[model samples]
Target: MTKGGMESVELFTSEGKGRGLKAQKEFLPGDVIFAEPAYAAVVFDRTSTWATTTPWGATDLGRCGWKAAIQRGTWGCWLAVADQEPAVPRGAREPMASWLGLEREGSGLAEGCLVSIDDLQNHVESFSEEEKKELRVDVESFLEFWPPQSQQFGIQFISHIFGVISCNGFTLSDQRGLQAVGVGIFPNLCQANHDCWPNCTVIFNNGNHEAVRSMFHTQMRIELRALSKISAGEELSVSYVDFLSLSEERRRQLRKQYYFDCTCEHCQKRIKDDLMLAVKAGESKPSAEAVKEVVQLSKDTLEKINKARMEGLYHEVVKLCRECLKKQEAVLGDTNIYLLRILSIASEVLSYLQMFEEAADYAKRMVDGYLKLYHPNNAQLGMAVMRAGVTHWHAGLIEAGHGLICKAYAILLITHGPSHPITKDLEVMRVQTEMELRMFQQNEFMYYKMREAALKNQKIHVMPEPSNETSPSLFHKKE
Candidate 1:
């Protein structure tokens, strides 16, 4: 894609999928198809209570109304800070038809209560009873904060938008840790359809790692980049859910959260499903029943690990991962997705616990598995390799760590632009690791002495871990 022209992709009506973007020309890995600025971005902050004018408040209105505001694109969103003035209207609001992305010329949809809003994505129909109940709770809560002046717009409009957001809302993340900090809509981003293994990846380019606040929010934009070679006229697609998951699980998430069943090749044909769930069964080979049994067990263990990790039970996460891994390694292939999941979680959790040697081992194994499954320049692969490198570095395996770090740096240079904060940090790590590798080679004894001293003073990081922040203890001066 040309930096200035944004000509690589064009919006087209995709068969089966409605509005979708497609490659207008061939695109190599790393080529950015296009970028879309946030249509309605609101960074949630405790310091600043937000306020927006009635009917269409971007920042001020709570979640549901915020989506409606972005759809209209008329109201200026305001940050309620001391001495800060309320945002004025951008212009006269567009007609309700345009607000809904209706093509009044060909399709008469101006008067209908369609689930698809012009602000974000497609229509959604399914909502579970629990979801309906939760939505009403949200609506009731919204009513508490909603100003009476805007009561003219009936509950039907609010209910309609709540459903719109249920499926289409995008979480905004901070740059450094990729931590969720807010929500926003980039309507054009919705044009890309879903695939299990997409040729393109969406990047939230926030540019800054600082807290999402006034003025800086403008810096947030979404970029769609080719994950690999994409042929001209091929429909551009992205995964709506985690691709690491089994086809059944991935489809379930898509149907429940996104209200669409993925028709991607992997999902339709059960590609990777066997390998992901396969269990070793000696010479006889595992039966489908056997595979299902182990898969269920693995899922249960993983569910526990997730809960433990979220609850900050780092030790329990590590223990459960080890137990699962012991069973998995005995019964599953080395590259089994379930084993990979345990390794991935264990590596990070062990790192948080300051168990660098164990962490490095798990991290290396996880990276090896990822390399087999993911494209060479896959962002997740690059990050996995980078984590493995950092873990090795912390374990004082300078040479091995340096090599992996450099490899990751090269891959990330393509997947994530050098301007990206992650890529920049990896560059720094690469240089630092390279320097240490050289110094260790020059005087191995002094290096170990320094490392031991550094480790003695280093502290284990706590939960809600700071990502990629663990530096080699070589910074501490040896006595």
Candidate 2:
């Protein structure tokens, strides 16, 4: 497959399934790996039309590949026949049916569509106990659609996703409802599912509006790899930070929907707690003190600590957080990602008290843990590094402080370009650092001048100010 000078991607499928991306060369942490405009993207909005029933009712549907794919899938729809050739008129009412085709300006726009081979690699699912309790249903929402040339156009429908998995991670969604016209690399970044402690990261480049770009030196084809250090045959991973779900809740959902039991360390630890909690609760028999104790220890204690922190009780927050860290570490281990967040907050309180040396040490430790777990370019990691650098400067380690500040500035530049709020902050910090250095130098110079004058026993005369009185007028008054 070829389109002009664009290298058309081919899916490396095995047993009717897509495999993960393989590295063509060694990639650096901040390197721009790959970027392709999304082949097809419909903004997830209230206006997205979904099928009331499967698409089998339409008779003219035999001409489209989408309809055939649906027939091959588990769900089926009735085929509807069009009395005349279907035309996509603007604002045409979407029929009271399920699944709609993309509207085209004309036949020319239709030819520009890019539906990749592995577009249907995975599906969305809702597996949380909370969600299940609310819906009491096993199924969750998903997107399906016809390509640009489908006959279902008279219906005027668009497909979309159900959750808020921030489209900021994708090259196509730099802005709301803005559509970019390139296809995603099939199963390259796709196989890497979401994680809080992802061993891999995706960097999109190549589009004019892309987040970051690394120019290629030679006329060579580029390949992609995990941005972070990974083992020889480790499973690829990416952060699902946009969801903000708890670890247990995320694992539950992933297991229910994705089908493969995630043996990721985070998931394993979460399942262990869940199993233990279940056993303890079962033994308590509703009125047991053990069950009540477990519940209070888990939720009530954390809630109280959170409330105290919110109410500005810094002392209580420090104490409770320390206690919580001890308990959590006993169960979750010191290396747990959540523990790093707790330590980071504690360092902030220390900084507020002007305990810069202690704060710097804690901030440094927090940053080290984050770098070990998360990709360096992540906003949180950048912030932690910035905090540690400032703390070191405040503690009077000028050289070490500047080094950390320089690193933080570089990371921020790569992760968040010049237009980002963090980049603006870094500029302010650079100016402030220079000002401090200049002031220190000026003070040293003045101190030496005063010392040399005193050692020489020299009388340094101060310049006199002009007298306020008019001497001529006073003498004339006497006359």
Candidate 3:
């Protein structure tokens, strides 16, 4: 129920959805709606044992694979320490437990400070009987490994804690971009609901460096920014899944993970449009084999390109990306998500190489894909436009360059704000393009004016003294 002192938003219960946040006042794009530190957070070691390779085999869990192991270890350690010490006041328990309702729900419990009966009931009701059974066993193992003095508080309590963590934990990444280093629960921030097309974005300000060596030393603060102009009383939402995904895929994901059906405007429109397009084209869905092939090709190609990038093989990266783009475009069409991703990479690599014409072409395609796939104020759109504009400028297409740059500036202003590094960079580009365009127009006008004057002078020179010529001609005719 915390508003975090943000005048623009307030806590409210969304219809059918539980408690959520809504706008209290109008918000312009890039406006900081609220910023808050996590009430309870755990920073884990970035190095995972699972990533280590041994003679037996390479064992690596996908992203955040080490989370469950870290959670179990922490719970075990907490229980062992509690057993040796006197019972502490409920208020003195870990900040996360209290913030997440574990303390209140587990009140009257003799041991296992993390256990919460009420929270467990709420959690279990959300899952099917089969899922509940599996969860019970998993919860029991964590508790049985490190039993508290009083065993009265059992698996149900442990299940609740796990449920809370699973549902609410936010992946804390290093400034190095999308690499998960830890997880934190910011209860106040989690009140915002999910929408397939979100109007706000979450940004973490950890530090100036692109990557931090240790999460323990990093101080992270989460900031919520308005992605577009939002009217008062509007719901504040952020996408939990990739917004670039198709409507059907997004809904399926939301149902599986968040346990809710999305009825967002984007979903409705996209579904309807897709159906209409299919009907008009008389096209049936692709076979599973074809779909599988495309997916595998996309994954394999992207992995190779990423490897080349990490190895600093820019030429290979560009060549691989171009080849992938051609295959993907033939199979997935220009607007497909996979093709868009390839275009983005190709555009960036070509621009870095100073191949302005090629870069501009790729960048323009990315802009088109983003426009079709992303929300109106999506930051990626602004970035794509900016890249295209810069390349166009370099290619000497002043009009197109200036126009696109201006468009990018408008979008970036709302998404990144005037003070952001990206906004500042775009502002500089916009100014440079403006000056260049002005100079171009001035030169063009002068050239036209000079040519007009030269033409008039030539005509006068060809006419020769009119009166003297007329008199000589008349005299010669008379003779």
Candidate number with greatest TM-score: 1
For model 1, residues 31-88, the per-residue Cα lDDT tens digits are: 7777765444445432333432223223433322222332232222322222222321
RMSD of each: 8.9, 20.1, 20.5
Candidate 1 clash figure, as a count: 0
* Candidate 2 lDDT by residue in tens digits, 1-479: 00111122222332222354333344445434453333222211123221111233312222222232221111112122233333222121121112322122221222212232224332324334554332222111112233345543332112111111111113222211123211122223443455556654433223233221111111111123244644333444565342123457666655554444445566656533332233212332433464444345545555775676667786776676677655554444333445555666667766766667877877776776656554466644665687788888767655566667777887765554454445666767867766655655678666445545654695633222211211111000000
Predict model 3's lDDT versus the native.
0.57
**How well does model 1 score by local distance difference test?**
0.62
TM-score of 3: 0.61
Model 3 poorest ten-residue lDDT run: 470-479
TM-score per prediction, in order, is 0.76, 0.46, 0.61
Error of 2 at 326 (Å): 8.7
Candidate with the greatest lDDT versus the true structure: 1
Sorting all predicted structures by TM-score, with the top scorer first, yields 1, 3, 2
TM-score of model number 2:
0.46
Tens digits of lDDT, candidate 3, 195-301 = 87788876565434333333233234667788877788999998777566678887987775566788888887774344211211126555556656775787798
C-alpha lDDT score of every prediction, in listed order:
0.62, 0.41, 0.57
